[model samples]
Target: MRKKLPLGVSLFAMLLLLSSQAFAAPQSELWPTWDNSNESNSATFDHSQWQHLLDRYLTEEGQHTLFNYGAVSSQDKAVLEQYLTDLTSLDPRNYRQSEQFAYWVNLYNALTVKVILDEYPIKSITKLGGFLSFGPWDDKATTVAGQSLTLNDIEHRILRPIWNDSRIHYAVNCASLGCPNLAKTAFTAENTESLLDAAATQFTNSEKGASVDGNTLTLSSIYEWYGVDFGDNEQAILKQIDVYRDGKPLKGWSGKIQYDYDWSLNKP
Candidate 1:
């Protein structure tokens, strides 16, 4: 004979079941590694030229920053092209862990900017084509260490898998207003940790990041999509966001979660 549960107990059990399903483990496997352990120190990569260009083109506002994509001069563009060439020419596996981390991050951002420049006056990054007319993420954008790779490769295969840090999402911008604001300076090996923390903090605190109202919580689609990277469940995800939120209220944030994103070019 089966004993029927009480109504309140049944409702509580149902809620728990829904919660478990809602925050299921991420489908993708995350394997963290630092490719070059034999190297003691990171090689100094010259990003001053890139820094100079960013200073001239990146405009900062109260909460977010924008890039003056239309203002990049041909001479400046040449410098960027040369930078990418130099980066691609190097053997990434030869660099130290810190160096390689910064290298991949900078390479990804530089390439994103280049793609946007190549298709400037366009509405959004999705306009760029990938396999089957998707975004340019899967397009073979560059070669590194004698291997042809795409933006998706640099991010998902290399950075995300190697570092296993959810912060990588904030570091690599998609040249969209919905993405994290592009840092005004180049990410150097020395400054990489601090810069990453700053980026996460900034993004989590922004209106585009998340907001709590009454019993409802609204968050970026990023959290919804990459929720596993942040935490095992919504509670864990909210806790991670609070870490970078610097004393912001995430506790008692229950009920519903909403997501929003903007795909427009982040231009000034």
Candidate 2:
């Protein structure tokens, strides 16, 4: 009646399918509700709690910043939960654009950490998803201003679309080794610009972000996944990268361009 493929062939096919899904990025489409911001509003949002969590748990190991997911105590976890609750309770629409940017970035990162800690001792963040899901990104992580928002919603729908800044790719950390380093300090309206530039520079120079070999230019899957955010073509992408790259700039590369990402947990 039906024929089955060999075990080896089936395994290979499955791996290929998983790989394809892993690199798939969502498009940046605006959610009009989040587009409202008050330039005249001079209010400030507090993020010291998030910074405290980061200072205690996040550390630099080699070029990557690893979070101590396993070592976080129950008390600290409760504190984290409180911080997230306080963040989502407010309406960001009434805040200034600068403050709103910091709020979303901090919220996105905190929610990601909470997700991992809720189910620690895992090898990769990708494993948190369901049978057909690649990650917990699409799952409703938090409710902001009575609007249920997922990690994808905060990133793709809000931050990317509202700000329309390519540097945002460096701001939102995904709690993975391949993702950009989570900032050591919490972002504030005053520090967001500097933090964004610092992250871009650090990631562009690191091996996990971009590397060149003889004739080949290999990059993190982030560039390929969100290529449109980073200029949408090889030359344009390289140009944007060069702006942050420290050493000799990457010039013409007529050879193959490759992209790879590590889904492993960013933890010590």
Candidate 3:
């Protein structure tokens, strides 16, 4: 004979399991269509409109880069819509790999901003979804080359699988306070490399990304959620972080590792 758990205890355990599963990191499955990029093409996509919007709304306060979402003028909103329209109008497969990378990153970021602006005054991006849903990540946000895409699809399926670069995590913003800062300038083929390095360096050095107190190390939930992307283990993850930390490599704070994140909207 086996002992059964009390009803209340069983229910609590079930809820805990469900919550953990809900927030688990998505796998990087390739969307094969996106893998088709021309290597020799020299064409460049113009991201000036997005750059203008970023320059106008993104402001840095201490360690955080917040967007002035409430300050966006109706005219500027129109400009944003036009920028997205222009981006989606073309086929990224026709461009070079560098151009495609920049295009996808810019589109992903602009769509996230538009989602927040569409539902302004919310406390967090997670509120955009139903009780069981995890934000609007799975909801169709836009279309490109006749294919519909969600934030999740763009990130996990397209960007992550295509590049297989952990730095991709630093480039995509989710409009949340705990996410990597949204760049003040738009991504372009010419500047994507430097931008990725800068973003990684800025975030890894910030307390929000990783901090040490006594013998404990506290890190952003990004590493917890997407551990496989970094290295799938504590030692490998620490090595990735050390590559970006400002000064000498992190040392001694190996006692306890904790991960946390804030879900508040990244807005001023």
Native-to-model Cα distance after best TM-score fit, residue 32 in candidate 2, in Å: 0.5
Write down the lDDT of every candidate, Cα atoms only: 0.82, 0.90, 0.91
Q: Which ten residues in a row are the worst by lDDT in model 1?
A: 23-32
lDDT digits (tens) for residues 64-117 of candidate 3: 999999999999999999999999999999999899999999999999999999
Give candidate 2 misplaced runs (Cα > 4 Å): 1-19
Q: What is the lDDT of candidate 3?
A: 0.91
Higher TM-score: candidate 1 or 2?
Answer: 2
lDDT of 2 by residue, 1-268 (tens): 6899999999999988987776678999999999998889998988988998998999999999999998998899998999998888899999998899999999999999999998888998888877767889999999987899999999999999999998999989888999999899999999998999999999999999898898878899888889899886888988899999988777566788899888889998
* Per-residue lDDT of model 1, residues 1-268, tens digit only: 9999999999889867764563232344332342554386546777777787788999987666888999999999999999999888987777777888888899999999999999888888877874234358868899876778888788877888778899998999988888888988799878988999999999999888987777777888889888878998988988889988865568557588888888888888
Q: How close is every model to the real structure, measured as TM-score? A: 0.85, 0.93, 0.93
What RMSD, rounded to one decimal, does every model reach? 9.2, 2.4, 2.4
Worst 10 residues of 2 by lDDT: 246-255
The candidate, 1 or 3, that scores higher on TM-score is 3
